[model samples]
Target: MNLAYQAKRSHLLIGLMSGTSLDGVDAAMVSIDTDEQKNISSVSLKGFHYVPYSDEIRERLMALCSVETARLDELVVAHYAVSEWYAYAVSQLLAATGVSAEQVDAVCTHGQTVWHVADSTPFPGPNGMMPVRASLQIGELSVLAERTGIPVVGNFRARDLAAGGVGAPLVPYADMILFRDAKKGRLLQNIGGIANVTVIPAGAALEQVFAFDTGPGNMVIDEIVMLGTDGRQRFDEGGKIAAAGSVSRELLEPFLADPYYRLAPPKSTGREVYGKAFVEQFTGEARKLGLSFEDTVASATALTALTIAEAYKQFVFPGMQAEEVIVSGGGAYNDTMLDMIRQELPQGIRVTTSARYGIPDDAKEAIAFAILGHETLMGRPSNVPSVTGAARPVVLGNLCF
Candidate 1:
């Protein structure tokens, strides 16, 4: 650990995030303030930058994420490659902000989640059967620290998983810090590759907040779009393609029936369940139904929207009184996804993007990990037990000094 960081009341830290989307490394230079009570009194984003992955890197990451394609040697190589990429992103961010590494406290990175298994996943055990809840986030902190000459915090999910938690949706803790409203109940919905919601009741305390992944976000939609475009395009980009096509209930219903959706809160998921293989199955279904490219993309988009509303209604709305859903992540930019969500949502609830509050939809996740990094340095237990089904609260993030 950096001695200077230990003694500071406020520190400038770069938080890094590489989500399931295989998009890019997002770094946010954040200025965070903490009090004697170990609570965040003030937090602000100083600067942010995103460094996209090349086609080759994205392809390797996709292979490593698959059981049939993953190679141990490539996993090791990609791990270091991702760290270098993250270090490069940090340099770019500092240049963009005119800041130096020595002036910063640390780089807190969520790394890249190659594989994640929640508590509900059964595995063979010593004497009987048990749930093997574990997670992996590459981009080694030691490598990052060596490259950047800055204290690094990495592999944040391990601690939570060790404590018998889902090791995901760690952003909810940051959501409480960044989006908690005193007078109004708000839902912070992050529609990244995988969609998740953080339900904050009006004036609710830390313990009252709850969150869970709401099932497929832009992950499925992007996959369908990629297939349709033959890698010519990456995403729907404003929902133009999806808007051009009609939703197919035939295709969307089976996805809604996924067992993961029926699981209660304190749950989470990732590409392991919704990655290449899943996309292949989805494509197969679309072909069997003879759906056009636009209709397939539209169905995938609607699946995301319908499942989000359904999760809120069945699990969240019963106890929490939320007036609006503050959306973030890539899905927020998809007008078609938003429109579908609004149509399915209850009549009184309003939907809006996080841009309305200040954070850009794309930068919100990156900004979140930055806050979590700060909390970790403060010796704060940042994971919400209520949201992750953890046995107890534990300080997340491993330090590479």
Candidate 2:
């Protein structure tokens, strides 16, 4: 029960994430041990928790992402408040689980992403030099570190984006390290607001590993539920709405045709492409087709399943084959979505949650970053060039103590 015990080689981290959907804060207390050789497999999930945001806060954050910039300044302050909320979550997790944060090596926080225009944004200089493509995550780390008295490694995405990597779908590094199966080869699939997958073929070199955003995850489904349910529910509860109605391939086929789904690995997306505006378009099309609320939900779920399934059969699997697909994130909890995936998948591909292997589906993304922090502490690079198409292997994130 003494969670304060030092790791074998003096490395341990608590990873934190509050994703695009603004659902809540995820915090995981992890134990990491590594040798001088830099081969890491020793990992333990000591504790974890997902703290839901209050309705007021969730709405405020959502508004900023789509609101008038004249009111943007307040959103920046709200981001700091997010970090404080994150700190509270981390503290509650330790107290509830009997873990001591002071003993941990680092706290890896994937702060909330306000804007992720990787290839946009104006460069700051004379003569209005066009701003290079970059992104920003705006949870002040100093708040978390100062409040918790822990070394915090945040801004996980900027470094990779700066180096020309997509800076998204970063979980693949953890996938290759901890989830790879030498015999069967494995595919680690995350279905958050966006769906991404990493292919770990048996005997595959790091160069051979591949990953990318495989189209819609929960973004569309959640959005559809929001409008259809009049905000009574944040998402399609257990996909019951989807189950209640039939899908119109007409509404879904056009989405399936989106070029983003067909994009190869090293590609990334966010609320930018599939945010609320996109959902409005979906609802408008469904209405034009005379679809019911239930039908719209069903079509939205169909899109999620088809995109992921299509990405695998089309882009992810050619020379490589994965017998088992390990699923994680909020989408894994939706039975109807999973059923859709099972229906669409080619025969013999088994679907299971990452939680079955002791990683909470909701906690997996945050936990991956916690693991990434441990890697960075040990002089290991968390960005995989093959998977992310980064120009080179570079350490990700800026550490703030």
Candidate 3:
């Protein structure tokens, strides 16, 4: 069968995304149709399902994320195990939607990112020391394809990285396909474990778009909540803990001073910079100030909000003024976080969730991967060179059949 021909027509694709949140796998069943130019003409959600990760799996994955604790043996075991988890998610999605594996065209997955180092670090090469940018995502695509009996498209970051790009914020190309407008410049802000923004200038072409990770989204706040409650709570539900507490400028000031905030676009970061160790240090500073648990959570939430607003003020506002900030991902549900972000942003800019545009906030990323997977099958270059700082635009994802 001609995969590209099939992709040009209407097709059903399931996108699976397990973000840094480590909460669960989101499976989005999307119906996509491409225009004569092979650009997405119409897209709609058919069904959505989520599979929560067990405590044991979460612990194992968390261990793999840290360099100090990640072992080769564990990585080998978890790689296949995570594929099983992804298969389970696909099965559950099929069951929920009453669809068959043969009926679907492909399974697009953005495997769980364990470690993402977008910045260059010197490492021993074949000849000598060389600057390398590396990232690893661990769900095996072959295993997922075998279990699901459908072709799989995944590891979407590797090709971009190979082309001298940061290999992230890969969703900007998809964001343009889904949210771009002719009259209004929009900022697509996704607040997952890490918060990233895609700036789509009004009526801009794909080459004109750009994006970068603003800073920690729910990552730092979730860590603080877990630390404060002794693992009793994984997150501050509805931002209630933060709402109940006070923001300590003492703690917020230092977090705002993080050098990552000042970095130019085409950048990305993950648990590497703001993971467990960073949270431990943050908690130590909070203790030095004698701050309460709620106060610490509040301050961390403020850091997310302020950093995002600051990124926009410094980078986005000077060139393209976005009329709206459309938020998606786990952070969209955090009322206190949303309120803080709104306060920090300038006047006349609207803040809203992706749901307002008919895309579920939680399912937006999953749906994006589905579109990306379709592009891969159609032999299209989906990576935005401007957003990723790649030498050139390139098709992303490794296909497994």
- TM-score of each predicted structure versus truth: 0.97, 0.93, 0.98
Tens digit per residue, CA lDDT, model 2, 1-401: 11332234646689998888778899888877666664664888888887998888887777766634316677768868888898998898889788687676778988887666644556667776665766667789999999898888888787787777778778888877778776887888898888888888987777778888887789888878877777889988788889999989988888777877666667877877788788889999999999999999988888888888888888766778779888898988988889989898878989999989988889888888988777666666788888766788888888777
| 10 residues in a row with least lDDT, candidate 1 | 1-10
Clashing pairs in 1: none
After superposition, which runs of candidate 3 have C-alpha atoms over 4 Å from their true positions? 1-8
lDDT of 1 by residue, 308-365 (tens): 9999989988897889899999899999889899998888888999999888788888
- The list of candidate 2 runs beyond 4 A from truth reads 1-10, 36-38, 67-70, 120-131
Top candidate (TM-score): 3
Tens digits of per-residue lDDT for model 3, 1-401? 34555645688999999999898899999999877766678999999998988878998899898988899999998888899999999999999999999999999999999999898999999999999998999999889999999999999999999999999989998899899999999999999999999999999988889999999999999888987888888889899999999999988787788888998888899988888898998889999999988889999999999999999999999999789999999999999999999999889999999999999999999999999998888888899989989999898999898
The positional error of residue 395 in candidate 2, measured at the CA in angstroms, is 1.0
Q: Measured by TM-score, how close is model 2 to the native structure?
A: 0.93
